[model samples]
Target chain A: MLGLNNRDTRFFLIVIALTLFTPFLLQPFPEGSAMAQFNAGYPDLMQRFAIYGIFAIGFNILLGLTGYLSFGHAAFLGVGSYSAVWMFKLLSLNVIPGIILAVIVSGIFALIIGYISLRRSGIYFSILTLAFAQMSFNLAYSVLTPITNGETGLQIRLNDPRILDGEGASQYTNLFGLDMSSSFKLAMGDYVFTFNAGYYFCAIIAIAAFYLSLRIFRSPFGLMLRAVKSNQHRMNYTGLNTRPYTLAAFVISGMYAGLAGGLLAAMDPLAGAERMQWTASGEVVLMTILGGTGTLMGPILGAGFIKYFENIFSKINDNILHAWFSALPDGLEGFLVTIIHPFVGKGWHLTLGLVFMLVVIFLPGGLVEGGQRIKTMFSRKKNSDAASDVKPAE
Target chain B: MDAILLQTLNGLDKGAAYALIALGLTLIFGTLGVVNFAHGALFMIGSFCAVTLQRLLSISYTTIDPEKTDFLGNPAKIETPYIEGWFGPEIGAAIIDWSVPLAIIFAIPIMVTLGFIMERGLIKHFYNRPHADQILVTFGLAIVLQEIIKYYFGANPIPTPAPTAFKGSLDIGVMIGFDPNAIIYPIWRLIYFVFSLIVIGGIFAFLRFTTFGMVVRAGMADRETVGLLGINIDKRFTIMFGIAAAVAGLAGVMYTPINSPNYEFGMEFLVLSFVVVVVGGMGSLPGAVMAGFLLGILGSFASMNEVKQIFPGIDQIIIYLVAIIILLVRPRGLMGRKGVMEE
Candidate 1:
């Protein structure tokens, strides 16, 4: 059972199954159909879902467990990416070496930042982390141009000294000899499903990351972290130095973020300073909150939900809206289109903002809690019904 | 000396803006004990108020006149502003030219109403929630407000120029016994600095002299004690929120000519203003203003060529660097009162 309880084992298995069958599950609509435009079974989109899922999962470890909301995680992500691309340029196009270096570099980076930032707690901690990230971003964009390649971003070039791969050994990133972008397409009846190598690779790593997080969440350290979140002052009063524990959690989460960033570079072989921006940090926070911050499966669900909306909902234009509403009366159709227009296509962020607001206002625990509430409500109704039946019989 | 003075002068207008926004942020934090992320959006909306008024004033009717023939020998078409038709042509043109200043009047009521609604409708429910929740909800509101503006304004910065009188630069070096043209500053920038000073002075005088301001200050010091004294401090807090919104909005209204109002300007300023608020201490008004100007002036100094030669890219991160150092060293900020957001 992988050191998990029965319920947790089942949950782990469910996640594995979902990750494995995402291609088929996401491609429910038949090929060439209007609904097929919403199908998110392609290689590019699937890879993003898994990668961002890893990112959100990593973010949740620090924020959810220790309640230390660091708004600078993207700095680690950007550092990891830059390290990875450097590996690709200097070492080889192979992903393993690049990814390993990425994790190490970002781990060290996180250790330094976390050491400084964890000195303060609460909103001050948040501000400190934000400042560090902003400084990193500013430096990367200006002074650190030699390493980061400045505004144009760091990318692989043809004539660079790729020591391991020699000269001109396939510019694309690979795992050994297998190209990451290669995919196997299957068609049956009117349905088409793509089995992408990059997605599966990301999925495997995401699963491992999730398992590691699960272990961390159930360990004695996790209990200590929760204690820290609930009452750090009390922990200090008990003569327990909570700084090391929080710092450890911060570093671990940073490594997870680095691993995600490495995978991203492995898929694309490029790094940009924009990845370190505050808004990028905010996106991960959004995913964590929208999914149910402290829950196990919430971040992944939130990541997928958001990525889906960003890709599919934003593709629906006025032409598609007109086609869909063609059967309705002219005035009513026009009214509905006008009403729905702002929430879709280019205005997807508007919908995202509104949904995030509503979630914070009403569903603070997010989608996972909403599901739990519904389940409890149904069970309670059943219990009451059983009680009424016994009374009637009596 | 002249170079230093020029940089200081250059920093003044920007410092004025930062002070105004941070002042409002401090006011809301002190009165309501809520971390409002949407305060920057109020500032943005204020700038847009000027843009909106300018657009409204330029609404025109077209007429064809046979007296002036076109190149193709057809009657020429003339477009005239509705204001010009209502009043004389000269008066209407002047009104259109002075739209940016006139927007102060237009933006005040709108910003105040928006602030009241934000407090009573949304923020009122979150009074007892955690700071994280307040930050998240307000951040969401900020995004929503900016996105709504983007939808209307099409994501471009609209140019709202100042009146013709203040369009030129002023050479103050001659009057100050320096060489001619040693210090030439923009007239509008100087005007902005004076206006911000007046606004800051007015806020201080109101807080020092007025009964409402005194009661609000007492509530900020001890809310439970004020409530126990049979005073409706919540109503006064709501009014304070409106006033804070107006302060931010007026700053935005005046700032239109300097940077041109854009949807993303809210977010850009929000991050800097948050840093300013933190460096000033969370709930201290004078601290906010002083820190705002200090950081602003420091930023300009860092951007100077001499400083950049010593440390490249320092200007971009000077405020954040200072904030980090201060937060680590002092923790309470420059003028922070005890027991206010210490946790």
Candidate 2:
């Protein structure tokens, strides 16, 4: 059971099964079907699902467990990416060294930022993190142009001194000659499934990240983090220093974000300063909150839900809307299209904003809490049915 | 000396804007004890009011004129704005030219009503929630507002120019014993600075002199005691929210000519204004005003070639750097009262 309790073992196994079979599960629709547009089994999108899942999972460790909402996580992610791209340029096209360097560089970056930002709690802490992130972003865009490549971003060139990668070797990212872009397409009857090496690589790392997070969650350290969130003042009164604990949590989460960033560069060997923008940081926060912060499966679920919606909803346009509602009466169809127009296509952000607001207002615990409520409702109904049967016997 | 004076003037105009926005933010925070993320959206909507009025005035109808012929030999058509028809053409043209100033009248009621609804429908419910939740909800609202504006305005910065009279620059170097043309400043920028001063002055006098302001200040100090005095403090706080919204709206209205109002302008200013509020002390009015001008002047000075040569890119992050240093050194900010948001 990998040191997990019975229920946790089952939950972990289920998650593993889901991630392993994602290529099959996501492609519910067959090839050439109208609904195929909604299928998200492609390599690029699937990799994003796993990568951002890791990002949100890491973010939840700090914000969910310790209740320190750092608004500067994207800076660490950006640093990781830049380090990864640099490794590709200098050392090798192989992803191992690049990813390792990414995690290390981002960890140090997070440590410096976290140390300074954690000085104040609550809104002040949020603002401090925001300030640091904005500063890093500005520096990356201007002063640190030599390192970050400025606005054009850092990319691998043809004639770089990649010492570890032999002369005339493939410039693409790879693992021991296996290209990340290489895929095996299985066409069975009307359905086609793609098994991508890059996706599998990202998937394996995501699973490992999840398992590590699970261990951290069950550990006494996690319990201490929860205590910090619940009552840091009381923890201070108990003569115990909580700074190290929160700082550790922050650094670990920063490492997780770095790992995600590394995987992103591995999948596509390019890094941009836009990755460090505050909006990117806000996206991860949105994913964590939407999925159910502090829950084991919540961040992953939230990441998938958001990525899926972002892809599918943005693909919808007026033409598609008209086609979907063609059977309805003209006036009614026009009304529906007009009403729904603003929530799709380039207007996806509006829908996201509305959903986020509603989630914060009503479903504070997010989708997981909603699921729990439904389960309890059904169980209550079953109990009532049994009581009615007993009354009839009496 | 002229260079210094010119930069100071430039800083004063920028500071005026920052002070106005921060003052409203501080007022709401002090009175309601709620951290509003959507305050920037209110500022944005105010700028749009000017755009909206300009658009409304420019609506035109075409009339066929038999007296003139088109290039195609068809009847010539003349397009005339409804305002031009209602008033004389000269007067209507003047009105359209002065739309930015006129937007002040148009934006006040609209911004105040929007603020009232935001407080009653959304913010009122979040009063007892955690600060994190309040931040999230308000942030969401800000996004929604921005998107709505983008949907209408098509994501372009609309130009709302000042009146023709104030379009030119004024040279003050001659009068101040400097060489001719040594210091030339925009007339509208000067107007904006004076206007902000009046607004800031009015807010202070209101707080210092009025009974309503007294109760609100007392409520900020101790809400429970004020409520215990059988006063409907909630009503007054809501009114305070309206006034704050009006102040922010007026700032946005006047700022239209300075930086052609765009949907994203509110968010751009929001971050800087938050820094200003924090540096000024979260709930202090004078502190907000002082910090606004001080940071604005410092910002301009940092961008100077001599300073940039010594330390490059200082102007880009001077405010944030100052905020971080001050927050660490003076945790309560410049003039922050004790025990407010300490937890």
Candidate 3:
């Protein structure tokens, strides 16, 4: 079972299968069709799905388990990205060293920030993290120009000293001579499935991270973290030091964010201070909350759902809307398009904000809880049906 | 000495805005026991009210002038604002020029109505919920409000200028027994500082003197007791919410001339104001005001060239850094009451 219970192992397998066949599953619509615009099987988006999947899973550990809502988690992600780009600058274009350094550096950042921020719980903790992140972001955009390249972001240069690579190497990020962007496109008539090196690399890491989260969810350490969330006073009375546990969760989640950032640079070797913005941190929070906090799969699902919606919603223009509703009567079609216009196009954030409010109000447990409720409803119906068949056996 | 005086003035100006927003936040928090993440949005809306009025006044109609030739040698189109046509051009021009100040009249009613609706419709239900739930719901609401503004305003900072008279710099240092032109400050910033003091003072006076204010203060201290006295405290809290919204709206109204109003400006101030509120001690009005000015001054001082030379980027982060240090030392903040979110 690979250290998982029966249900967990099954869930894990299903997730792995889904990730493996994502290129197929995501591109359900064939080419040269209107629905193909919604297809998210492309390399760039698939990489994001995996990368943000890692980010949300890590966030869930701290917020869902320890109940310490760190509003500056993006700072760690930014640090990881900066470190990764630095690795690409000084070292070789190999992703392994870059990703390793990213994790280590972000871990250090998390330790320092976590140690300071974890002193106060609740809203105080959230503000402290926010303040720290804003500081980093401002510094990165201004004072740290020597290191961060200011607003332009960090990128590769041909004249740079990459010590590991001999004479001439591909300037692009690579994994043992395999370029990150190198992808095999399998064309089956109307459908095309892309298999990118970066996506697979991220997918594998995301899977491992997801598995580790599952183990943590079931472990005694996770139990302690949950206890910290439930009642810290009781934990203190029980003579349990919740600080170390919370800190560990914070650092672990920080590392997850770091890994996600490193993977982002590995896919496309660039880093920007914008990654450290409070809004970016808020987005990850929205993902974790909108999925289902404390669930192994919920955070990942939330991340993917948001990314997908962001991609699809932002792409819809008046033309597309008109095309979709062209069959409707003229007035009705015009009315529908006008009503939906504000929620689509560049107004995707408004839709997202509204969704977050609705989810917080109606479905606090997120989509997972909704799924569970539907399941129960079906089971209750079956039970009622069975209860009405009493004369059949007689 | 001049440098110090100038920095102090700059700091006080910055603090004035912070204090106003923080005051509103504390008022709502103290009265309703709700952590309003949407308060910043209300401030942004208030700023936009200035922009809205400015745009409204400049609603123009074009006419082809027979005498004026176009660049293409045709008759030129002379665009005249509707206000210019209805009122005299001079009066209409003055009205447009003083849009920022004029926005106060427009913003007060709008912000108060929005506040009343917010309390009655959304926040009333969240009173007994966990603080986290309150935070999330408000955060969502803030996003929605901000996005709506962005949709209309196009994410750019609209430059709403101060009146023509106040646009010039004032050499106040000489009047205060300093060298001539030793410390020159903008008139609008000075006005903003004085305006904030007036608002702050008026609020304090109202809360201290008025019968309603006394009842509300009592309700803040002990809601159940006020309720037992048969004095419908919830309606009073809603009214307080409206007043707080008006205070924030007025702050935003005056602030447009100093800093061009943008959709994201609210978010920018939101964190800083929250810091001020926390540093002032949650639910403490005077504390919120005090912390706002103190941090604003400290932040200004941090941005000084001498300070920046030694601790580069200190200007950007000094307020937050000070907040962290204070929180660690005094977990309850500078003037925070005991047992008010002490945990």
Candidate 4:
């Protein structure tokens, strides 16, 4: 709401509809098409899309709203994931309890870390968080080996006694008669579209999160957060304690990461220490900046874009390039494939670098601003014509 | 006492590297105010330079030797370098034999040009951006650089051996009269420590004595004021970047023999070096150099058996534990200046 106007709401709805329905529409792409790859229908990837989207959204609340650049958010996510997995192992595998545990644990962690880290603002805050996150990562990797399972990653073993199942030792049953692994598919004229049930479940959760964010954006609490972002010292002089507000934002965002991590473990019951790594934390920052920080939809769009490209681009190989380029001249095709070969698979990272660089350089406001500029350009032409036509009527 | 002495010796070699890399990082941050996430990548590239030199020297074509027999009673296969065809056998063989030592000359120019390109091409565009943006872009650049290295060299670590003359360990225990092998240390590591000290001393002396270094130091203190005095601060900053790059590169080259060169090696050093830089005070060169060795020795001690007995897993988090304590007690770090971040 800070950035969005009335028209933007309509555009956002359209984009969301497109994002949701595209999978169903692209079902019949003869197994492989550019459109088919966009099927946000796969359970694994769609779960990730929602999980990472939630993580980015939470990140944006602090970074975008409060202007504090945290470099260690992944520690909370990792902590949340570990907490949730432990809940599954120790208590019930029902996701709700697991998620609640994750949020509570991660919030406590953020409370401690934020209390100290938020003492300094700007770059110092960033470095402090980074240092603390590194501490968490190291601890998780080594000292907490029994809890985190060290480098091999923490997973749900068959030996994990499902106490909720009453000594039956079976996997936890899904609540509400909703199958987590089930997929909904539609077919029409060689086009088959499939959507995972977990996706819809995740989608519903995302919408709820988005609505909460919207409410936050509109509330007096959000205003205080913005004021803190603009000028903390001034807010302090105005008799409003900035500490509580900043800490609140930190805890809220930490819970959001916790929820995401919990969902990730639910959809796939494995949590690795690598999830808590500084690089993983840095990734959400990149996603937020690249999408359009501070906007409700920006982080979601950024998450989808990054994940899609990461998956699809890494899948591309020499054969794929050769298939497309073979339609050209014999010599030219070979040359083109070789040129494109290095930028795919492991080389996909190069593309990510270029995208990040371009986004930072030319689109500082991110894709949200880029979209706004395009809309303004189109609307200006219509507005000018309407003004000239209205002059005759006047 | 012997164990303590050995650990101290172990730390000096590591401390020397930490100082060298942190010096470069602090130099760039001091002059440009940009937190370079790619400094580690430059260190990585420097190590690869050694790898390349080893590859270049070892390039040979195989040929069947009709007169000589193999262990299996077959004709022996002899290998000859391509250089032998162009140059005379004597010079070619000598050059091939001595390529690892010759990599220093090759690495200098390559590393310098890479520094110039990095500063001019990517970092130049981010000068006006926020620190976060600079961090992100440079980080992206670091990933790209590391990925390229991985693509070329594969994921495995490549051992870059030192010259044959410096292959064995030096027995410092015999001289000190504690058991003959108690203070045994690698010859290359000793050489590296000495080399680092000379380079560090030379850099310090240059800054202390030279007019160029004086102007650079002046620029670091205040760029606008130096610019007002009709000096080209941008040029000095660029040269400082080059110097920083060369320092990291040389550190990396010397380090190749200690730990094998791998794509992810820089990331490990990068994290520790950042801690060193923060502990040393963000823009203080002397602080960086001092803290590098301090942290290195402290970390080494934390990993020792005696330290482990006191704190079960202290080694895993010793650097960060120290960083947190320092930030809490002295937020501006040990020798940090006023107006620096004080938590």
What is the descending TM-score order? 1, 3, 2, 4
The C-alpha stretches of model 1 lying farther than 4 A from their native spots are: A384-394, B69-74
Q: Give candidate 2 misplaced runs (Cα > 4 Å).
A: A384-394, B66-76
Lowest-scoring 10 consecutive residues by lDDT in candidate 3 chain A? Answer: A385-394
Model 1 chain B TM at 0.98
Candidate 3's displacement at residue A194, Å, is 0.6
Candidate 1: residue A280 Cα off by (Å) = 0.9
TM-score to native of every candidate shown: 0.98, 0.97, 0.97, 0.93
lDDT of 4 by residue, A272-372 (tens): 99998888998898889889988877898788778877877788877768777778999999998888887887688778877877887788878877887
Local distance difference test scores for all models: 0.91, 0.90, 0.91, 0.82
Clashing pairs in 3: none
Tens-place lDDT digits, model 2, residues A1-394: 8998987888888889999999999999999887888899999999999999999999999998999887888888888899999999999988999999999999998898888888899999988988998898888998889999999999999888999888767779998788999999999999999999999999999999999999999899999999999999999999999999999999999999999999899999999999998878888888988888888788998899899999988999999899889999999999999999999998999999999999999988877777766766776687866443331100
The TM-scores, chain A only, for the candidates as listed are: 0.96, 0.96, 0.96, 0.90
Error of 2 at A208 (Å): 0.9
Report the Cα lDDT for residue B224, model 4: 91
TM-score of each candidate's B chain against the true B chain: 0.98, 0.97, 0.98, 0.94
For A358-380, candidate 1 gives per-residue lDDT tens digits of: 99999998888777767666767
